[model samples]
Target: MFKVIFRVTTEVRNTAGLREIKRAGFIPFMAKREGEEEVYEALYKSNDLEELREAITEAAYFLNKVNRKGGNNFATIYKVNDNYVGKGLGGLLGASLGLKLGGIPGLFIGAIGGLLLGEILDVELNETFVGVYSWPISIEQ
Candidate 1:
C-alpha cells in the first residue's frame, strides 16, 4: 500500500488559520516548538498509489484554486519508506492471540487482521516523518 501525506504548517499564534485548513480537508496532526514559533501541523492522506505519486500536482491544483482567492495556503508532501517494525510486531502479536483462541486458523486470521492494523500504523508513522522534530520542519535548525 502507498500513502501520500499532504501537510500544512503554521505558527501556533496563527491557529485561527487552522479552521480554513480543516475546511480544506486537512486534519490536526501535531504541534511543537520550532525556533521562536510554536508550529502547528495538519495533514491529509491519500492511500491510492496514483494519487500518492501525483500529490505534488494535487498540491499545485489546490494552491491554484485557493491562491486565486487570496488564500495563503501552502502544502508539501513528505516521503517515507514502507518497512517498519510495527507490521512484523503486530503480526506476531496477532498470531499469538489467534493461536490462544483458535489454534492454527485463529492464528492466521489474527495475523492478517493484525498485519492490516500494523500497516495502517506504519503509514501514519511515516506520515509524521518519524525521527524528526514534531514541529514545522522548515523552522527547525
Candidate 2:
C-alpha cells in the first residue's frame, strides 16, 4: 500500500467544503480542531503507490481550483511512504481512490477502508503496505 501526507490552508472553516469533498467520492478518516478556524488530518489509501500519488495530486488540484474560484488561499504538502515498495498490481488501487474522491477527507476514509480490506485479504505488509495523507486547513488570521 502507499500513503501520502499533506497540509492545506483554506480561507474559512471547511465543514461545507469537506462535505463537498465527500460528495466528490473520497473517505474521511479523521477531523479535529474548532473555533473560527480549524485543522484536519486526512488519509487516502490504495494498493498501488503511483495511483495514490495521482489521486493526491488530483485532490490538490481540485482544492486549489475551488479556492481560486472563491478567492481563497490554500497550500498542501504530500509525502509518500518511503519504506513501502510496489507490488505487481502497480499503483492502481491508490490512483483509483484518489481519482474517485477528489478531496482529502474522502481520500482518508477510502484509505482506512483499503487498509482494513488489505489486512483482511492477508496482503503482505511490505514497506508500502500502508499510506498516510493529511490536510490541515486554517482560516487566514
The most accurate candidate by TM-score is 1
Q: In candidate 1, which residue pairs get closer than 3 Å at backbone N, Cα or C atoms, i.e. clash?
A: none
Model 2 segments more than 4 A misplaced: 1-4, 20-25, 33-38, 68-141
Encode model 2's per-residue lDDT on 5-96: one tens digit a residue: 23454566556546544443345544554443334334445555566556655665565555612112222323334232332123346446
**Model 2 / residue 64 / CA error / Å:** 1.4
Candidate 1 lDDT for residue 99: 97
> Best candidate per lDDT, number?
1
Candidate 1: TM-score? Answer: 0.42
TM-score, each model? 0.42, 0.39
What local lDDT does model 2 show for residue 104?
66
